[model samples]
Target: MRKLVAFEHMTVDGYAASAEGLGFEFTWRAYSEELSAYGDEHIRADVDTALYGRATYLGMRDYWSAVPDDPAASQHEQVHAEWVNGVEKIVFSTTLESAGWTNARVIGSDVEAQVRALKAGPGGTMQIYASPKLVHSFVGLGLIDEFRIVLHPGTLGAGTPLFPDKSALDLDLVESKAFASGAVYLRYRVA
Candidate 1:
C-alpha cells in the first residue's frame, strides 16, 4: 500500500501562505543550498505522485512545466522540475475541467473514495504538495499517513493557515533537522 504524505512550508505562526501571494516565492527568504538539497532529496527519490488543490495545481503547473527547457534555470531547479513533470499529478477540484500537465488527472468528486483507492494500490509515496486547504481536508478525513513540514523562522500575522481553528492531531516524530537558513524540517507519522 502507498502512504499519503503531506508536505507544507509554514511560517513560525503557522501560516502556509502570506496575505500578498502564495508563500512559495517568498516564504523562505533565507533559502539556502542546504535547504534546496533537502527538498531535492525528499521529492526526487521517494515520492512518485503529487496531489494538489486547484489553485496550487495551476500555480505549480505554470511554473514547473517551463523549467526543463529554460536555460537560465539552475541545475537543481531543472532536475526537480523534471521529476515533477514525470510524476503522476492528481488534482482535486470541482471546478477544474481538466488538468493540462503531463501524467495529470482531475478527481472532481468522491475525493475520499478516490484517495483511499489510491492509497490501497501499490506505489511509491504520494505527497500532498503545498495545498493547505487540501491538507486540512485530508486531516479531517484521517487520510494522511505522514507529514513533512518545513517550519520557517518568521511569522505571518495574517494569512492562509495550515490548519483550521480547533483542529487537532496526534503525531509521532519520525525525523527532524535544522538547516543553516533558520528553517527546521520535521517529519511526523500520524498516531
Candidate 2:
C-alpha cells in the first residue's frame, strides 16, 4: 500500500503558520544547504504526486506557474520549481470548480475517500504540505503513515498548530536530523 505523509515546518512554539494567518514563506529566514538539498531530492525522487487542500493548491499553483518567468531564479530553484510544477497535483476542495495548473486535478468534497483510493492505487506515496485542516482530518481518520515535523528555531508565540486537539498520539520517532539553520527534522511513524 502507498503511504500518506504529512510534511510541515513548525516553530519552537509549535505553530505551523503565523498568528496573522501567513504561509511558510517568511517563517524560516535561516538558510541551510543541507535542508534545501533534502527538499529538492525528496520532491524529485520520493514524491509521485502532491496532495493539498484548496488554499494550498491555489497558492502553489499561482507561485509555481511563474517560476520559469523569473529572471533571477537560480539553477536549483528552477529545477525544484520544474519538478513541483510537473508533478501530479491532487487538490481536495468543495469550492474549487477547476484548476488552471498543469497535471492538476481537483477532487470533490469527499477528501477522505479520495485519499483512501489514492493510497490503494498508486506508484509512489503522496506528500501533503501545510494543510492544517486536512492534516487534522487525516490524523483523525488514521490515514497518515508518517509525519515529518521540521521544527524551526524561532517562536511564533501563537498560530495554527500542527496538532490542535487533545488526542494523545503514540508515535515512534523513526528518524531525526538537525541542520545548520537550527531546524530539526523529525520523522515519526505510527506506533
Candidate 3:
C-alpha cells in the first residue's frame, strides 16, 4: 500500500502557526532549499496528490502560485512553484464554494472515509501538508503512516499547536538530521 505522509514545519513549542492563525513567525534556515528539495525528491517523486484544510490550502495556493512570477524568488522557490502548481491538490473545506487554482478540488464531505479510500486506491503515495486539525483527525483515525517534521528552533509561547489533544502515540524514529541553524528534520513512522 502507498504511504500517507504528513509534512509540517513546527516550532519547538509544537505550534504550527501563531495565535492569529498566521504562520509568518515560524522561520526555518534554508527553508526554500529544504522545501524545494523535499518536494522534488520525496513529495513530487512519490506523491502526486496533496490534501489540505481550507486555511492552509488557500495560504499555500496563494504563495506557491505567485512564486514563479515573484522577482525575489530564488531558483529553488521557482522550482517548487512549478512542482506545486502541477500536482493534484485536494482541499477539504466545508465553507469553500470552489477552488480557484488548477487541478484543485474542494472536498466537503466524508473526508476521513474518502481519504482512506484514496490511500487504498492505486497510487504511489499521498501527502498531507500543514493541516494541523486534519492531521489530528487523521491521527485519531490511525490513518497517517509517516510524519516528516521540520523542527525549527523557535518557541511561540502561545499559538496553534501541532497536536492539540492529549493522546498517547508511539512513534519509531526512522531517520533524523540536524542542520546548522538548529533545525532538526525528524522522520517517524507510526508504530
On TM-score, the candidate that comes out on top is 1
In the range 13-55, model 3's lDDT, one tens digit per residue, is 8887776636645764436565546546764477788889898
Q: What is the lDDT of residue 161 in candidate 1?
A: 90
Output the TM-score of candidate 1: 0.96
Least well predicted 10-residue stretch by lDDT in candidate 3: 27-36
Stretches > 4 Å off in candidate 2: 42-44
List TM-score per model, in order: 0.96, 0.93, 0.90
Q: What tens-digit string does per-residue lDDT give for candidate 1 at 53-87?
A: 99999999999999988999998888888889999
In candidate 3, which residue pairs get closer than 3 Å at backbone N, Cα or C atoms, i.e. clash?
Answer: none
TM-score of 3: 0.90
Alpha carbon lDDT at 11, candidate 2: 82
The better-scoring model by lDDT among 1 and 3 is: 1
Highest lDDT: give the candidate number: 1
List ranges where model 1 is wrong by over 4 Å: none
The residue pairs found clashing in candidate 1 are none
Residue lDDT tens for model 2, 48-85: 88888888788888878888899898887788788888
Ranking by TM-score: 1, 2, 3
